[model samples]
Target: MPIGMILWRWDYRSGAEELGKYPKELDVSDKTMMQLYSQHLYGAQSDIVSMYVGALNIISVWTGSTHNYFLSLLLTIEEQPEDYKEVISDLLYYLIPFIEEDTFNTLLPSIYQRCTEFPSTNLEQRRAMMYGSNLNRAIFKTLSEEGCFYRDELKIWLEDILKTKLYNFEYIIDGLVQNDILKTSIVRGVDGTYVFLLKYLICFRAPPLDLSQKIKIAKDNELNQKILKKIRDFFKKYVPNEQDNIEIAGYIRQTNYWVIIDFLRKSYAKHSSLTKLKLHGVDQVMNLVNNLINSDIVDIVVDQNEEQVYFLKSDIILDFVPMNYMINQIYNMHVEDRKPDKLLLSYISILKENYLESH
Candidate 1:
């Protein structure tokens, strides 16, 4: 029942580099993993296959150095001469399971972008429902008999989407509130408004405004001292008062360390000559330097008389953190929990053996 071979075959697609040359002798014509998995697993075989393949594509698109295979496929799928509707729906369904929590966080932006392209009323609603359901499942990690978002569920949903790009604060607030994604009067509350602004700052990493500037904006209208206090508290929580070695993984998870790493990686990829990257806030930058060094994701170099700098360690494998975390989770489930998912364990094993052995 274990589909170890599928994971083994799919391992080659997981890297950040361009796809490697496929073996000439291997055959994939008669059965595209769909036929094979159909025989072994429950549920629609085609659905599972599409989800797995689409996940590989998502991983590639998210991490690819130069090209986006997902977008390219989207153009092709959209223009399909026949069966376009079914293909799009199935693709959307399969994609939900594979979405990386840290990368997309919330599925709204991803789903919304695609829905806007199709413009079908029914399709839009179906996709919205699918996205909302999947998001709820992801947040709760289990389905409730009654399908509805409770107050706490709505709060988590808000926080997740808050991390995504918000072009207009007022419009988003009104829309979400009106749609019952948030409490009707939540936005008007001091704590609620403050939380929103703090999230915006963290999410965007916008250029810091001085205390007077921030307070001026806060006090200029209805927003006031409570807003400023929230911002100050966020700085306190994220920024350290004194120098200390941070617990790397824990700190990264708490403060979205992946975002910082992604930013640095993109900068390095853009300018090959750039040897160092500078970041702001928290104890001449607490946690990042030590975290990067500990993760082996970057090389730390100190200037003779100045600040420390970080260089991306090119040989270090991409997808290390998430992939390793996944592998560990599977191992724990199998050995520690007295329950085993042989298929998933096989996938993790093949992935690690093929690409992560060095790590």
Candidate 2:
């Protein structure tokens, strides 16, 4: 089938901004794109269609502007349902490196919704998938997956992972850190050298500060004597709500509710900005994460690994343990009709007192 008619019909003017986004001085060459997408494209008369489409897609990704070609790639789930997951995953592979902040944040939820159609791909997905690769595994894998390390330690680790020497690697490091995706700590040397060390990444799923502030004010009395019952019901209420309760709710409360405490533990991890949710019962866990996110108990979500990870707001306990906060406010909602758990009944009390402590 001719792809030209499809894109033209779908995008034609795409929008009025089309002409303005592309400047003639950029000196884009047909050979450049042909060589880049050689694997996906063959030298055919039909190649003209792909070149135009490719230009639009790259333009959207870099400039944060939405045109039909970029929109087509995003709506692949609805438009091209066959093999949708693989195609979307491929888009994510290279999309992260250059996607503009507004474009990424606004469209990601839509991208993730389609992603939900398939089963869990991997819990090991990392933000590194968004950057340049020398045609192999992503080079930033170690930084994303590994825990705390010194500046020199990371340089050596990257060399080991990429299997080559990195010359003037600081420039590369500067881009990764400076971009809105990741932020690093600034340290200066005695010789006036500047070294950027990865501190934490900003999860795209994070809630806005105003949401947190509004939640804090509105739900002031969320934690009362009845919180124990609410906590117990959280595990029991959602257990049966899922279609496949066996795998999804296997760890609900029957397994001693390890997931709840573990989430708290992840908050204290060196990364601090994001907490990796255990995938043992990802289906139900995600359901719970969504609830917490709405309740303002958690700040954000990142699904870079196909498995979802969340950000729990830690500042609630940063200054002092107040009577009301995200952790305790989790117990505010009402429980459904389910027998109360004797163990979870008392577990809430311990979680409240030891808000700072997690095992």
Candidate 3:
């Protein structure tokens, strides 16, 4: 079937009549397309459509719901289990790209509970427990609140709920710490109680400082020393001497390698084009590339590249590059000229295709 025809049929059945109101050839953002598709799928009377809609609703929630669409859809699906398998498939497909392993495990159990009412069927029960187990493990690995609570505290929390022992609690905590989701810190309280701070293990967000301000802040607060000490201590405590540099280098390489390659490729492509005169200067390109490379969303790559440069590979790159530039350009352009610029739009499209294809 033609993709458009299928979409249209689905839309009509799902009550997304407004989607049909748009001109047939009019282009829309992916977000708009998904929203319209969801509204249509959700509104349909068919069991299949309802199932698909339920899955899409779960995707919306995991990706940080901007609305209550998922909650409404969940309510709708709770009344029907026969319609759930199709919805589960759709949810798996749509949400696969948007979630991390940990987050999916954490959230899927709750989703299963709502979908199947603690399903007693062997297959259904297995799937529900698997999702819940995975999610809980992931959450325990990543979130400080889940990891730092002492064995006694953990036992109290799990008591009748989990029927697990103190040994099991320690095992889970150790596993999470090994996975880099929980970090240990020596926290000195105001009352002089020195406790080990177990907190979410995450990379630091970039300091909100411009060039001059960054320099001043670093100098005034002796931030460099503190940062160095933290790094030194973390490595000394958690990393064996033989593994310390290798581990840190791996992180840097994963994050920066892709941005460097892309910058080089774009530069080469632009230099060969007739539009070279209109392109940003080398310095400007370098600055933007540096900023993107250093951004928190990127994973740094450090190994020897066959192409000989650093790069970043993250889903955020798809949204970040164009959205960052497009908003500023749109502000300066007239409404009639507010369409996404050609290069930025092309880049976003390519990134999206690559992203979708990967998963």
lDDT by candidate, in order shown: 0.31, 0.32, 0.32
TM-score of 1: 0.21
For 1-359, candidate 2 gives per-residue lDDT tens digits of 11111111112243222211111123333343333234133434211212233423221111121222232232221233333433243444333432433344444443444344322322212222221133212323343332123446566767786675544244345544454222343223222222221223221212224433444454323321122233334434432221232222222222213354235433321222222344454345545655544543443433334333344442111111222232222233214312123322333343444345422
Q: What TM-score would each prediction reach against the true structure? A: 0.21, 0.24, 0.20
Worst 10 residues of 2 by lDDT: 1-10
Question: How large is the C-alpha RMSD of every model relative to the true structure?
Answer: 22.0, 21.4, 24.2
Candidate 3 accuracy as TM-score: 0.20
Give lDDT tens digits, candidate 3, residues 115-181. 4432223332232232234333334332222212333444456544555432234334444355433
lDDT of 2 at 176: 48
